[model samples]
Target: MHPKRKLTTVIAVGVAPLIAVSLPADTADAHGWVTSPASRQDQCFAGTVACGPIKWEPDAVEGPKGLKNCSGGNAQFADLDDDRKGWQVHDVNASETFTWQLTAQHSTSTWQYFVGNQKVAEFDQGGAQPPQFVKHRVNFGSVRGRQKVLAVWNIADTDNAFYACIDVNVRG
Candidate 1:
């Protein structure tokens, strides 16, 4: 090799390892999750219930825009899909406030709340970026007893949504 080419190759080899080391080992594109009324992943994060990887990343339960499962169709978070898991059930009033703790806010389309197959509440954002924290007043209406509420944050610019499931016992 030419003298100049040999020098260039030596510099490249020395700088490559430094560049790799300086880069982040793992990057988190986490969004958000229900903090109040304590969603399943939140329960796992808080150590209220024994869980898996979700304990470290409760804010990352995201999947495709339309999904009905608690784990957001993520197999790693499949623990959230297990109804038999000893999840803590909060006793809430007929009208309860659901709060979201956003790690990273995104341009949002809507926030939807559901019970079984029924949509109980929806707040449209119209492509606005949300704040670090968001809360919605959702009335249980006639829904009572032990129930699981699914909350979804639909992103306006992406074909994905952040999901969470909160277990509650609504007072009559």
Candidate 2:
């Protein structure tokens, strides 16, 4: 083949594959969820913590469901109480609050559960108690020594919204 034709052919061979690879990757909470044993004090998730089975109710006007720093829900942890993490003093009287939220995207269905750094109290969503927030509250148990908490979120649906939120306070 002619030099120009050969060069073009080689370039096309190399560049075509490169272009195809450059396509954006479909990421579905690829990082994985974060977890902290009851004995551990620190819990961190590099990304947002998505709650369980995402609830999707078609918007009256067709729009994404956005939830944020919600309040009221209960709390949850890998373990309710851990006797490990030997500490100078055990904290059993400490209490705090956390708020979580998320925004539901169109054509994205998935329940959100967050696991981020710094564990917070669990906040339940929807209640007979007024001042409703579309989020959950997590109550972190007690801590003896010193510890940090982190967590991340997860999804149950591939067609619902993917989002989560958490906030906590320590009073040990």
Q: What lDDT does the true structure give each of the candidates?
A: 0.95, 0.30
> Model 1: runs farther than 4 Å from truth?
1-26
Deviation of model 1 at 152, angstroms:
0.6
lDDT of 1 by residue, 42-129 (tens): 9999999989999999999999988998999999999999999999999999999999999989999999999999999999999999
Worst 10 residues of 2 by lDDT: 54-63
Q: Specify the highest-lDDT model's number.
A: 1
Give per-residue lDDT, candidate 2, residue 61.
Answer: 12
Q: Residue 32 in candidate 2 has what lDDT?
A: 21
Quote model 2's TM-score. Answer: 0.25
State each candidate's clash count: 0, 66
| Residue 135 in candidate 1, Cα distance off native in Å | 0.5
> Which residue pairs in candidate 1 collide?
none
